[model samples]
Target chain A: MEYPSRLIENAVGEISKLPGIGKKTALRLVLHLLKEPEGTTAELTEALTELRTKIKYCKDCHNISDDEVCNICASHRRDRSIICVVEDTRDVLAIENTAQYTGLYHILGGVISPIEGIGPSELNIDQLLQRIENNKNEVKEVIFALSPTMEGDTTAFYLTKKLRQFGVKISTIARGIPIGGELEYTDEITLGRSILSRTAYQQD
Target chain B: MEYPSRLIENAVGEISKLPGIGKKTALRLVLHLLKEPEGTTAELTEALTELRTKIKYCKDCHNISDDEVCNICASHRRDRSIICVVEDTRDVLAIENTAQYTGLYHILGGVISPIEGIGPSELNIDQLLQRIENNKNEVKEVIFALSPTMEGDTTAFYLTKKLRQFGVKISTIARGIPIGGELEYTDEITLGRSILSRTAYQQD
Candidate 1:
């Protein structure tokens, strides 16, 4: 489509690059910004620029942070001995939102996906191993909380193989039907796994 | 949700202010941008800032433009006598994509909507009228291509009252069931209107 202005075209082009945002939605967002006060756009520009320029990852966990170490890693209340390994910062946020997991995180940045040419060496696997080796006694357990996907499982398997000699207790998150999920609606493989991995119940 | 870093929080807050973007979606987008090359965010920032700071409106039609007069209004190939009036620049672009009309555009900026506290004076209605009055007999037709909503109809009615003295032909785009639209799913009002406004078939 022919844009009346090059400025608008450029803004739309940049905005539409975002995931799940189409050309139409991008145009709507850009126009919404145009309609608001000039300060709004300025603030957005500042926020994005500062986020990219000033943003850093926690040295220990590879999570996005504003400082040398993230707040989660630095917090005294968190369980440093138990680290939940995951894909990216979003997973960290997701797990944090649950409020059930108090353990520190190990963001791999991404999974080991051969299709995408991503491997163990490209991720923060070495740092994680170093973290465990450095605090062998302090870090007692390493938990694999990655997604239930081929890539996630592959990454977890690779990590497990590397971590076998560390002598720490290695575990993975459960692969059962989700809470409030109906047995009938569950996918065949998940339902099958949920049944096969069922724990023995002891009556109260 | 608890953000690990203040910078990520700030960026998410600013991004979520955009229309149709919720906090969760905002976080996802921010994380996506963070995962991409740093230059991507920098480019978006630069584009948004430049667009807001440097974008101009056409003198003849209040459409967003790089210069004083937009390409559509200034182009010699366009039918200067016919002016298609729309609610916003998006509408102009939508119509332009159809490649059916070659007329100059008169962007109203928005329709008359009292619920949102928007009125005729807030729009470029006066400028449109002034353009017609100034052009006089040179401009022969005024087309109302705004959305077929109550506000659009009200705005068109008001413009027709003001444009009556100019002795120019006025028209509106046809409103009916959309092409390939299922009759059973069409809303009663639109279906009725489609039947009422049925045109004679000029078959080959």
Candidate 2:
């Protein structure tokens, strides 16, 4: 489409480079920025620039952070003996929102996907092993909280083999139907797994 | 959700201020930007800043432009005798994409919406009147291409009253069931209007 102004066309082109956003949505957003106060655009650009240039990854867990170490790793209340391994920072946020896990996190940055040329070395696997080796007694359990995808499984298997010599107890998060999901509508694999891993009923 | 870094939180907060974007989506976009080369963030921010700071509106049509007059207004191929009045620049783009209309356009900036505190005086109504008055002999028709909404109708009614003395022909884009829309699923008001304004069937 022909844009009336080169500036608008340039803005839309840059904004649409983001995933899930198209030319139309980008145009809408650009126009919205134009309609808003000039300060809005300045604030947005400044924040994004700061985030991209200054943001740091936790030295311990590889999670996005503002300092050498993340809050979860620094917090005294968190269980240092246990660490939940996941793909990216977003997963860390998702699990954190549950409030069910108080253990530390190990963000792998991404899983081992041969199709995408991401190997174990590309992730934070070495740091994880080194972290466990240095604090062998302090770190007792390592939980795999990655997605139930082929890449996730491959990464977990590879890590399990490498970490076996460390003598740390390794486990994975359960695979089953979601809490509010209906059994009839659930996929066969999830439904079957839920049944196979059924737990004893307990009285509230 | 708890963000690990203040910089990330600030970026997400600012990005989510846009329409249709939420905290999660904003975080996803922010993280994507972080993963990309630093220059990507710099380019995007620069484009948005330049767009907001330097973009101008066409003097003749009030459409977004880089100069005093837009390309459409400057084009000699366009029919100067006809002007299509729209709410904003997006509508002009939409109409232009169809490649059917060759007339010029006059953007009103926005339609009359009393609930939102928008009035005729707040829009480009005066400029539109002056434009028509200055080119009284050259301009023969003024077409209303605003959306079919209460505010759109109100704006049209007001403009019709004001432009009655200009002796120029006034028309509006046709309103009917959309092409490929099923009659059974068509809304009542649109169906009623389509039937009321039924025309003789024409063969392709």
Docking class of 1: high
Give residue A200's lDDT in candidate 2 (0 to 100): 90
For candidate 2, give the docking quality class from DockQ: high
| Best of the candidates, lDDT | 2
- Give the clashing residue pairs of candidate 1, or none: none
Put down candidate 1 lDDT per residue, A105-202, tens digits, no spaces: 99998999999999889999999999999988899899999999999999999999999988889999889988999989999999899889998899
Per-residue lDDT tens digits for candidate 2, residues B90-145, read: 99999999999999999998999999999999999999999999999999999999
Ten-residue stretch with the least lDDT total in model 2 chain B: B195-204
lDDT of each: 0.91, 0.95
The list of candidate 1 runs beyond 4 A from truth reads B182-184, B201-204
Which clashing pairs does model 2 show? none
Taking the candidates one at a time, how many backbone clashes does each contain? 0, 0
Each model's DockQ score: 0.87, 0.92
Model 1, residue A167: displacement in angstroms?
A: 0.7
